[model samples]
Target chain A: MPYTAEISRTNPGCFIFLVDQSASMSDPIGSGEMVQQRAQVVSDAINRLLTELSVKCAKEEGVRDYFHVAVIGYGHTQVGSAFTGGLAGRDLVPLSEIANNPARLESRTKKVPDGAGGLVETTVQFPVWMDPVTNGGTPMTRALGYADSLVARWVDEHPGGFPPIVLNLTDGESTDGDPTSAAIGLASHATADGAVLLFNLHVSGASGTPVTFPDGEGDLPDTYSRLLFHMSSVLPSHMRSYAASQGHRVSDATRGFVYNADITSIIEFLDIGTRATELR
Target chain B: MGAHSTHLDVQWFLVPKTGSSSEECEDAIDVLLSPETSSLFAAVSDGASESLLAGAWARQLVHGAVALMSAADEESVVGQDGLSRFVVEDLLARTVDQWDGYLAKYEAERIARGRPITWYEQPGLDKGAFATLMAVHMREAPADPENPKAVRRWIWRAFALGDSCLFHLRDGRLLTSFPITDGHGFGITPQLLGSRNRNASLIADRVSTATGELRTEDELLLATDALAAWLLSHPEVDSGGAGRQLGRLADLDQELFAEWVQNERDKSRMRNDDVALVRMRVKTEG
Candidate 1:
């Protein structure tokens, strides 16, 4: 019952995404058949997540403001808002604004099943809010600190609402310092519903089977992943249940950490928790 | 068909979800009165909240159900007990066809006004619209054709898909509850009628039907899932107290009903969702 608070326009939830834009992010990931830059993968993930959230909260009039979101990019010894276009320097913009003021819409071709035994090509409109930018070094600690301020303010304002969720996408190399304490400080913020959730997505150059929502860090590839795993918050019960339903092996101790794989599915987990149980 | 003196009192109320304006109510109700044929039709539909243009779809479905029930021939298969399934399924199929045309026109109008469908709306539109449906048809049996003054009885038939329910009460005691019998039976995913579904057999397999006789002073209640779930979950319902309470509620206006629903939600007794109810009373002499 802790995370069961009803999310409405009056008591909206919050999401703060921390993206790592260090020079190391330019390195290519994955093997021969499928190769992509870490920065590009992270940018694509963010755009897709935004699209999923918009679709989930869409109504006849437009998107509803059930959540406020902020995207922070860390690099070159500074951390600041990553949103471009009309929302360039803004933080914690309402979901409706985010849906309506995308930087631009790109037409992308996709292959979908045609209800027959074959597939057909179709064009889809993809909205972009941020572009890939790699700078000097990863100031992950500062990024977490920035999200800490947002989460703290959100909890103070909406004390009775579901706690804010902070997702950090990084390459596990913190140029400033170990971000453990910052991550802990960010996750410590709480509303009446529960403590803030801090999840981590580690985009590493090391090649290994992608591990997602692992219960323990013993199987992690290196010390960097283990450190980030320990910094990540345990998956809330509701999120764990959703992950289980999606065919992922989950347990009470499972932490929200994904390494070298698509993290866009996390958007679905977020929507499931904030879903309006009753039609309004 | 001959004109007959039969009286039926009907009332309906609806409330949107918490934090939503009344204009956003997704549940729809319709009452069809055919005085010449001595028949009365009522229907209620709850649109899927996750689907696009659900409220419009729900409105269309309820109106379509009543129109089909009213226009069917008395000697047709629709009038038979086991064969009504075909009629109801056909009605849904036709509604699906109409929905296709409606969607085309809606999209065209939006584009003509320079506000075409957004990227966020495209995925949901591909899935089409969805809703739950429940309908009732009541007709007065011909008074002894030879003795026009003889008292007449009414035969009522109901068809339901998903969680919407029909309740019958006699002498202020609950006599019957259709489709869903208990609160535990309700679930997040009820059988929904999709706008693209054209398989009549599939629809028929999911539809439930019930028939009964209505005498003077009998009361029938048709409610969407939220209120229906509350009625089944209330402790007093099994003892007939809930039926009496509902009968009293039938006389109140929409504003009062909305207040009552809000009070229930405040007390955490009812789930916060769109609620709708239609109450019908039988009168032998009026």
Candidate 2:
């Protein structure tokens, strides 16, 4: 019954993203063609996730505040809000404010099918809320702790609403200390619907194949991914079915962790709106 | 083709999502019944909540379907076997063709209201508003045209493209359900009719058509996804199920229907979505 609460404008859900801004994030992320700095990758991931969420909840009037969101950056000495532009210094803001207050919109071009078996070039406005910043050490422990405070406050405020979802985007390098206890503490926050959900995304320069939402850490090549995986919560059933529908192999044991792969699809898993269920 | 003594009592109940207003409800219904005639045209559409102008498009679909059905040949009402592909294909094509004009008027209204299209709403608008449609054309006819002693019966031809369903009941027990078989069959991504879709063949392929006859006291219910899913999930058992609820709920007014839907939503027995239901029963006057 937990995680079954209706996410609506009146009883909104929460999303707290923890982004790693450590010096190690300055290094390149992937092995193949599309390589980017870990900081940029995580920043883009967060932005893309936000964009998708906004679009998913958009209506004729405007984007409804079905979720309140926060972006926290952790590096060097301090862990704080990462939003830029009009929303700078804000912790948890309504989604409509985030949608309207992006730092700037960049014109990006992409190829699309032209309906005649050919491709057409189109320019789209990409909104950016945070820029890549790489500083000193990876203080992931503090990042999770930061999210814990926000989740605790959110659950207290909306005890009958859907529990907050905390997603940690890191490089698996925690300089301050072991972040396991902090991760556990963050995931323990609860609302009347269910306990807070903690999902992890590891974007690192480490040499390995990227895995997403694995049922176990058995195939992980190193300790970093294994640690991140173990810290993650089991995929909620509503999201599990959606992810499975999207061609991802998942089961009851699937954890909400991704290693060097796109977790933006997870945004699609959130049920902010409805159509009908099409035949499988 | 002539007016008959047979009469059908029709009623509809509508409820928006728990926190939303009636104006914000995406479900739509349009019915056309001429005075002193037994023939009726009805359409119900459930708009995709994620799409822009979905409610308007849903309203447009129902109105258009009923209007078009009014002009179509009465004898073309399909039987238990095959459906006229042209009729369904034409219905969708005509609706899609008119969407551009609707969009133009909507744009003007939005600009006048100072809420011009924003970046986030662009994608959903470009993809077009999508909704599930179920429509029916019903009329009274002789039970057996060749048999002089046969009584009259009501015949209905219906087409469904998504989770919105049609139910036939006899003596308060469900005899059949269309488009969606059971409650578990409903999901978030129902087959949608896009406002900009022009593929007649594709639309016809996905559409499911059913024809049935109702006796003097039999009932027919056409409902949007939320109520339809809940109704279909509860099987027609001899002791309880849809039978008990049907008898009690058939006469509920707007306020009571809203309360019933909210009660079910509170208990988590039904998903929190907008609900629309059309209830009809056949009657004969002496």
Candidate 3:
């Protein structure tokens, strides 16, 4: 089985990463000054997913030949740059060049643990695609609608095969509109062999309890989380291997959401998700 | 002639990625010809390009069909209407039933491994592997001296699931031909001859158009897609003449014909498929 069911290294599916750039995510997590900032952690995690996906493309034939991928970041009620293209608010660009292009360094910093029991701050340039932007309210509902169009077109072309996966990393409710219907529609579009999988990475509040939605409660105003979770693709085996290598163990049963302030869970999730999609 | 006498010549053309392997080709051809009373039967099955293991499927059909029919002890038919028609139908049914079982076991194995089943999601038909089949049975003619040129009669009943060809040539002219089943272009291309939803029975019924007498000085040539294209392009060369050439093949260098085919003939006109040719000379009139 592939990593993200639909997105492969070859004709890798399009992944629209809807990051929560609403000023709140910048806060430190759990009163731990020692831990890296949440924004930095999220960016690091996205970078890790991109690296894992790129490596998979080089090693796996099916992933290299069949999978085509694109990453779109939605934040502050508007679309941001694609992970590979760096274009501001462009439509999804299929990932043909990203896998073949030479690796270049993008400026990003993270705290590395000093081997001698203490934590030493280290700044390293990483391969970056989309920079985090914080501007307005979370338009998660609108993002889901946009995802529906993108995914639906892909499914129309590959109806008898696995539908592409859409993984959304968000921490709050949508301010634009109800995203439940769009998410539901996305989940229903699958191939004859397998269906589309949508998963959400919920980064909880820093100081307070994390806000989670779609907890089987009809009272929730939006079903954004519910639909995203439902549309998440199956976690492939090799991705689990990558996650295990990254010191995060995940099983096949693990769905889209892995919530915590550490943001490491999101990194692991994307790593696994990207790797699974690369499988033949 | 004794009923036990076998007369048909079978050549299995492994079309690049299609058809049975050389090792299994004999066994598969034997299976399609298992009727003891009428020992002569020839078949050429072209593997589906879309399938991952099209060659294996073709081999399985031939071997399984012959074994099943032989065990059943089906009555032997007479003439073109009898032999070709009956054998094609019988082989098709037997092959299909066995194929269903094969698929069932395959699915079971997938379930055991806890892997998502995608065995049937072969690449698109245009780019994928698939097979076509053509089988023929010949009977000995009666011993009659009235007509010196009296030739044996042949029942050339054929079934085509894919693009392979079954040709009958008499006096250097085309006697009759079977239609190739052109399937839906995209998605799962329809199985023209082999088992995949549409089996030999349905395809034989749909594609079979010619059924009649085959006279001596006549030749029946059955081929896979590539060789069929090659044979069709070279209209000037008589296969009957080629059949005669086989007798003198050992005296000449083996490279001569291949060199002629590649260097002398128009390169694009040749079929890239594995070629299987069967030629029988009629000795008596039926």
The candidate scoring highest on lDDT is 1
Residue range A1-280, candidate 3, lDDT tens digits: 3223333322345555656676666666545554655665676677666555554343211113345555555566565444544433455554434543423465656777899888888765456655555556777777777777777888778665555767777666667776767777777777664566676776756543332222332322336444545545445455555656766545655455554434545555666555442232
Residues A42-93, model 1: lDDT tens digits: 7877788788878877877688888899999999856989999999999899
Fnat for candidate 3 (0 to 1): 0.00
How do the predictions measure up, each by TM-score? 0.91, 0.91, 0.41
Compared to the true structure, candidate 1 yields what TM-score? 0.91
Docking class of 1: medium
Runs of candidate 2 with Cα error greater than 4 angstroms are A31-33, A114-120, A246-248, A260-280, B1-5, B77-81, B142-150, B235-241
Q: Is model 3 an incorrect, acceptable, medium or high docking prediction?
A: incorrect
Please state the error at residue B135 of candidate 2 in Å: 1.3
Model 2 quality (TM-score): 0.91
The candidate maximizing DockQ is: 2
Q: What does candidate 1's lDDT look like per residue over B1-286, in tens digits? A: 5654558778899889888887778899999888675788999999998888888888998998888888773432234444355685669665887998999998999999888998887888888888999988887776787987767788788888888999988866778888899889898889888888887877777788888888878998999988988888888886788788878877888888888899999898888889989998777543
Candidate 3 to truth, TM: 0.41
lDDT of 3 by residue, B175-243 (tens): 555554221221223344545443434454554434556664456666555445554544453544533
Better of 1 and 3 by TM-score: 1
Q: Tell me how far the alpha carbon of residue B16 in candidate 3 is from the true structure, in angstroms, after superposition.
A: 12
